[model samples]
Target: MTTDELIAPGTTGPATPTRRGSLRPLLLRLHFYLGVFVGPFIFVAAFSGLLYIFTPQLERAIYAHELTVPVGQAKQPLNDQVQAAQRALPDATMVRVRPGDADEATTQVIFSRSDLAPSHWLTAYVDPYTSQVRGTLETYGSSQAGPVRTWIDELHRGLHLGDFGRLYSELAASWLWVVVLGGLVLWWGRRRPAKGKGRRRLLSWHATTGTWVAIVLLFLSATGLTWSQYAGDTITDLRAALSWQTPTLPAASGHGGHGAHSEHAGPSGPAVAATADQVRNIARRAGLDGPIEIAVPSEPGAAHVVKQIRTEWPTKVDSAAIDATTGQVLATLRFDDYPLGAKLARWGIDAHMGVLFGLPNQIVLAAVCVAVLALIVWGYRMWWHRRPTKGGFGVGRPFPRGAWRSVPTPVLIGLIAVTAVLAWYLPVLGVSLIGFLLVDSAVGWAKGGPAVPARR
Candidate 1:
C-alpha cells in the first residue's frame, strides 16, 4: 500500500511506511491499545507525583507554627528540651531527638507509645531556648513526614487503598516506559506531519509534546518503579546481590564490649549513663553536622546512633554511633565512601523528589509534570475527536490477519523472551499485559475472528 492510501480522511499525513512495514503496524496496534486502556492510571500517577515534589513548600507552610520559633540567645540544653517534650506526652517513650539546624527552628523530640505501630510515632516540637513545647504531631515511617505530608504521600503511593491500591501505582509505573517508547516509535515512523485541522492538529500537538518530554518521562518512570511495592523489592534484591546497598558505619570492636546494658539506669546502676546532651556532643565531636538525628539507645549496652542525610545535589549521607554511657564515638560512615551503584541510587531518588539540585531541580521537575499533564489532556482530545460514531468504542481499527507472519521469526522470539523476563521481574505488569492480550483475543473472536484489512 502507498503512503497516501494509508492516510485516514481529514487527517494530515506523511504516513510514510518504513522498511519494517509489518513491525510498524504491530507497534501501532500495541500503542493504541495501551493508550486506550492504560492511560488513565498513568495520568493519575503523574498527577500524584507532581503534587509530591512540592512537599517541602507544602509542609513548611502547614507546619510553620510547630517547625519554627523566634531566634534567641544561647539555647537550653538538649536534656531540657527533651524534658519539655516529655511533659507534653508523658506516656510516650522517647525514641530520638532532632535539634533544629537554625536558631529559629524548633527541636524535635520523637516518641513512641505502646499503642502505636513502629512506623507511627509522635513528635513534640520544643523551642530550644525556652524549653517550651511548641506542638505535638503524628508522623510515619523513616521519612518522618508530618501528618499532612503523610496523607499526601499515602495518596501518591496507594490512593489510600493500602496494599491493594499500591498495585495501581506500580502497574502504572511499570507500563509508563513502554507506553513512552512506543509513542516515540510511532512519532518517529511518521515521516511527514499530519495536515489539516481537528484530530490532525491534536495528533501533531500530542506527538510534538511527547517527543519533547520523552527523556524526562523515562527518568520519572525508572525512579518511580524503584519505589513500587513489588517491583521495588525485586530491585532491592537485585541491587543487594550486586553489592549495591547503601554503606553504613562499622562499630568499633570494643565500643559495646561492656555487654548489652539497658538504656534506662536503675537506682543502683551506674549514675544514669550520659545525658541526651552528652550524646549530642559526642556526635558533633565525631564530625557529624547538618540536621543530624540522634536515636536514643533502647537497650542496655546499645550505642546511640546519629544519622545525617542532606539531599541537596552532591548529596551527603553520613552516620555515627556513640557509646551512650561514655559518650564516645564508636563508628562513622561518610557518603564519599559509597559504591557507585549506591551513589547513583541516592542521586536518582533525590533527583526524583526534586531536592537534588535545590531550586533548579524543583523547577525542572515542575515543568516536566506540567508538560505531562498537557500531553495527557491532548491525547484524550485526539482520541475523542477521532472516535467512530458507529463502532463499539473506537480504539483504532485492528491490523489485517497474517500480519504476524510478516515479522521475522527471530525478532518475534526475541520480543516474546523480553516480555517474559519483564513479566518475571514485574508481576503486576506481566499479569496486566496478559489480561489485556486475552481480552483483545476474546473481542477479536467475538467479532468473527481477527479483523482483516479490506485492502492493505
Candidate 2:
C-alpha cells in the first residue's frame, strides 16, 4: 500500500494527478459548500444586480420633473426651499435642501424626526422660487418608492435579517469557494494536462473563464463578508490614519491651518448640525455636482457631515465632513477612500451593481446570473443521471431525496415535515428557500417534467 500498490497497473500506474497544498483543498471545499448552501441568496444578489445597473437611468426616465427642472427660469435659494418643505411638514425636523442641476426645475427638501410615522421622509417637486410644494411624498410601507428601495437594499445586504442577514451573506460567500473549486474540478477533469506545460487553446478558454471568475468570486466574498461585519471598524481605522477628529477648532486655528491640524483632534463621531451654508460652499468649491446632505452628529467631538450622491458613472459618490462649531472641513471620502478591506467591499458592491466596469460589467454579470440558473439545471441533470432508473424509492445513501424509499416512508416524510416547519420558522432560511424554489420551479417547467421531453 505504501508503494501505491492499489493501482495494479503494468500500464504505467495512472499518472499521479497533481496534489495541491492544504489551503487549496480547504478553499475548494469551502467554496463548494458555500455556493450550494447560499445558492438562493447568490441568485437574489445576481438578479438584483442585473436590475440595479440601470437604476439611475431608469429613475431619471420615470421621474423627470421630480429629478430635474427646466432651464432658464430664476433659481431657488437653498434656504427658501428648506423653509417651504418645513411649512408643508411642520411636525418634521428640517434635514437639508438640495439645489437642482442645470436642467432641474424643482428644488428638493428632506425632513425627518424620531416621532414621525415612518421616522424618515423625503419630499420634492417644489418650485424653489415660489416656495410652493407641488408634490407630497411619504416614504414607508409598501406604498412608497422608499420602501421599494429599502427592500431591494435589504435583499442586497441580507434580505432584511440584520445579523442573520450578515451571517448568511458571509456563509454564502464562503460557499463561493466551492463553486470555484467545482468549476476547477469540472475544468481539470475535462482534460488531463501534461505537467509543467500550458493547456490547449480550447481548454485554456474554459480554464481562464473559471480562473477569472474565481478571482472575482474570492474578491466578492472576502470583501462582502468583511463589509457586512466590520465596515465601521474599517472606516474608523481609515479615519484614524487620516487623523480626522474634532472637539472644536480654536478660533485662532481657522480654515487655513485646519488641514495640518486634523491629526491632533481625538476620536470624533458625527455631528448633528454643521452650518448648511458653509457645507454648501465647501462642496461647491470641490466641484461636487449633486445636492449635499449634512448629517447631524450624535456624539461629542464629532464632525458635521455632508453626503454627495454623484451622478457620475462607475466611481463612488463621496461624503465630506466639516466641523459644525468650527466651520472647517474635517474629511472627504468617496467609496475609494476606504481601507483595503472596505475598498474590497466597495468594489464588490460596484461589481454587484454591475457598474464596476460600466456597460460591459453589467452584461457580464447578467450573463453570470443566467449561467448560475443554468448550473442549477445542470446540477439537477447530473443528480438525475445518477439516480436509479427503476423509479422506485431508495434510501440510506446520505443525501435527501424527494423520492423517499427503502426505510419507512412515514419516518422519512415526518422528518422532512418537521425539518421544513423549522426552516419556515427561521426567516432568512425561509426566504432563501422560497427564492430558490421559485427559480427551481421555473427551471423545471422550462425543462419539462418527467413525462415530457424538452422542447427544441
Candidate 3:
C-alpha cells in the first residue's frame, strides 16, 4: 500500500536514465507470493462475506414471528411488554430491553441469568401494542444476531472453529489491502488497453474490475483489521492514545469506561427495582429515541444506561445514564460528540457490515464481494496462462529473481524504511512479510548467493 509508482510492466526496468528502479518486479513477486499463499483465505472471506451480507434480510424473514407483529389500535406501556417477556422466561433474569419503536416490530426483552453463559442471552419478543409474548430466541453479539444469522456469522468469522479459525480472517484482513494496492499500482503503471482478446481481454477485465473496486476493498481491509484479534488490540491502543475511543456516559467513579463502570457491577445491597417503562421514560427525556436498549440496573443506585441502536443512515446512537433509584439523568453522550476517529470507526464498521445505508450499502458490499471473487479467479487464470506449455509441470514464469537489485539505492532505502514502519504498525503483515523475505533469501542463499543476481 506504500511507495510511489515504480517501473511499468514489461520494460527493461531501471536500464535507462529516465526510468526509476524495477520495484514493479519486486511488487509482482510479493503480490504473486501473497496471492498464491493468502488469496484462498481472501477468497473464502469474500465468498462467506457475500453470504453474510444478505443475512439481515434472511434473519428477518426467518424470525418474522418473533421480529414482527400486526399493528394495533393502541400500544400498552413498555412495562407490559417487559412483564410479558418475564412471564415467558420466569427462570431468567432480564438484562436489557429493546423496544419496538415501529408498530410492526416486536419489543425484545433480553435476559442473562446466573446459569446462562455471558455470550448467550435468551430474548423474549413481545408485541408492544398487545403486550403478548410472541416467542423467545437465543441471540448473540452487540447486534443481537439470532440463530440462523449467528450460524452464518460464525461460518464467515471462524468456520465454527473458535479462536483458531479467527486467524484465517485476521490473515485475510491483514493482507487484503497490500494485494489490492499492489494490483492497482501494477494495473495503473502497466497501461494495458481494454481491447485485446483472450488473455488480454481477461487481463483488461481483471485490472478494470480491481481498479474500480479498490476503494471498497481498501476500506473493508482497514475496518476488518480493526476487528482482528492481534491487530485490533494494537488499533484499540492507538485509538486510546489518539483520544479517539468511543465516548461513554460518565462512570460513578469517573475513572472507568462503559464496561468497567461500577454501575454495571452486581447488586451491592438491597436495591430498588427499575421497571423498563420507567427507564424508557427517563431515557426519552434525555433525547434518546427510536429502537433504544435499556440496560437493567443491577442495583438501586446503578445507572440504567439506555442507548439508541439504529445503525442505518441518520443513525441515532446517543445514550443516557439514569439512576435506577432516583430515576434521575446521571449522564449522557451524543453521537455528534464522538471524536473523528471514533466516528470513522463506527461508520466504517457499519458500512462494511452493510448496515450504514441499509439496502444500498448491502448492494455495494455484494458488488465488492463479487468483484473480489472475480479478481481472484482471473488472477489464477492469468497465472495458468503464463505457464510454459512445452515444459513439464510448472505454473507461470516466476518474475526474475533479484528484482530489488534494480531499485535505486535511495528509493530502496526509503522503501525499506516505509516497510519497517508498516511492519510495526501492522504486526501480522510485518511478521509475514519478513518471514516471506527470509524464506526467499534462504532459497537464494542455498542456490549460491545473498540474492540471486539477475540482469535488468
Candidate 4:
C-alpha cells in the first residue's frame, strides 16, 4: 500500500506500511526511564543554572562593600604586600597578590587556609601600603556572598560531597544529552495536532516552544558536557604550555655527607624581596594589564609566580605563572595562549552562561529556559493524561502486538544500563536512581505492560 493509504487521515504522521519499529521504541523506552531516573538532577541543574546565570548581579547585591575598597595613593611593593598579608594571616598560605586600581585603590593579597575539606576554606584580602586586613570570604557562605551561591554550588555538584559531588555533576552533565534528544522526539509528536481545534492549539504551542528550546538545550548540553568532561585536562594542558616544571627533591643525605648532599639541594636560595620598580617592570614586560598578583615563593629555590585576572572592560580574562629570581619573566601564559581545545573550554563557560554578548545568543538562552520549563509542565501533563482508567499506573494505551511488545523490556534494560553508568560516576544519584529503578520495575511488572504507549 502507498504511504498515504497506510496513514489514517487526521492522524499525527504519515503511517508506515506496518509500523516504525526496530531501535526507535527501544530508544524511546530508555529515554523515558532515564528521564524519570535523572528528573531531580535536571530540576536542580535548571534552577541552580538560572541562579548562576546572574552571579555577577548576585555578587554586586550581596557583597557591595567587600568588593570595593577606598581609592588611595601608591601601594607598597609586592614583597611588602606579601609580608603584610602574612603578618595579618600568619598561618595562611599566600596564593597571590592583586595590585591597586583606580576605583578600588587598595592592593589585595589573597591567602587561603586549608581545613578538613577544601570547602571549609577562607580567602583573605589584605591592603598593601597600610598593611591592614581588608576582608575575607569563605568558600561556603562567606560574608561577602551568602548562602545563595553556596546552595547553588552544592546543588550544582552533589551537596558538598567533594570529589564525589563533582563526579555526580559530571554524570548529570553528560547524560543531559539524552534529555535534550528525548525532548526533541517528544516535541516532534506535538505538531499539527487537529485542524482548527483545541488539541491543535495545544500541540502548536508545545511545538513552537519546543523548537525554540531545542536549540538552546542542545547548546547548553553540548557545552556543559564538554566543560565537565574536559575542563581539568584543559587546565593541565594550559599549565604545561606555560612550561611549568616541578624540580625533584634531593635524595636523603647520609648522616656524614653534608657536601655531596648539598650538590642536589636545589637552586642557591630564594632571593631578597625585590624593589617595587622591578616588580612593576616585570609585570609590564610580561604583557599583564590591570592588577598583577604576585605569589610569594614559599621556600628557598622556589620561583615566584605572578598571577592576574585581567578584568579590563570588554576583556574580563585571566593570565599567569612562574618568574625568575632576578625578576626576569620566565614561563608565562595568557588566556589567549590556551591551545585550541583549552580555548574551546574557556569559551564553553561563556556560552553556557549566555554572556557572549550578541543578542541572538541571549534570546536563544532565554527561550531555551522557557522551553525547558514548558517541557517539564507539558511532560507531566502528558503523563497525567495517559493515566489508566482501570486503576493501574501504566499508560492509557495498548502495546502494539508482535515485536513492539518486546520493545519496552529491552528499553528498560538499556535505561538500566545508562543509569548504571551515570550512577557509577555519581554515587548518591546512582543509589537514589537504583531505588527509583526498583520501584519503577515493580510498578511495570504489576501493571503487566509498558507505562507509555508505543507508536505503531
**Which is the winner by lDDT between candidate 1 and candidate 2?**
1
Stretches off by above 4 angstroms in model 4 are 1-31, 73-81, 100-102, 119-121, 127-131, 140-148, 161-171, 186-203, 226-277, 310-324, 334-337, 353-367, 388-456
lDDT of 4 by residue, 359-450 (tens): 45555665666566666665444434444445555542311223344345667577668767656654444565567658756866887954
Per-model TM-score, in order, reads 0.88, 0.58, 0.88, 0.67
RMSD of 3: 4.3
The number of clashing residue pairs in each candidate reads 6, 15, 0, 1
Cα miss at 414, model 1 (Å)? Answer: 0.9
- Scored by lDDT, the top model is 3
Prediction 4 global C-alpha lDDT: 0.51
Clashes of 1: 6
With a 3 Å backbone cut-off (N, CA, C), the pairs that clash in candidate 4 are 395-451
Better candidate by lDDT, 3 or 4: 3
Q: Write model 1 residue lDDT over 21-107, tens digit each, in one string.
A: 256666756766677667888888878878888888888899999999989988998888888887788776776788888889999
**Model 2 misplacement above 4 A:** 1-38, 61-65, 115-125, 128-130, 136-145, 160-167, 189-212, 227-279, 286-291, 295-304, 311-348, 355-360, 391-456
Per-residue lDDT of 104-196 in model 3, one digit per residue for the tens? Answer: 999888776555445667889999888999889988777888998888888888888887898889889999999989888777776345455
Report the CA-based lDDT of candidate 2 relative to the real structure.
Answer: 0.49
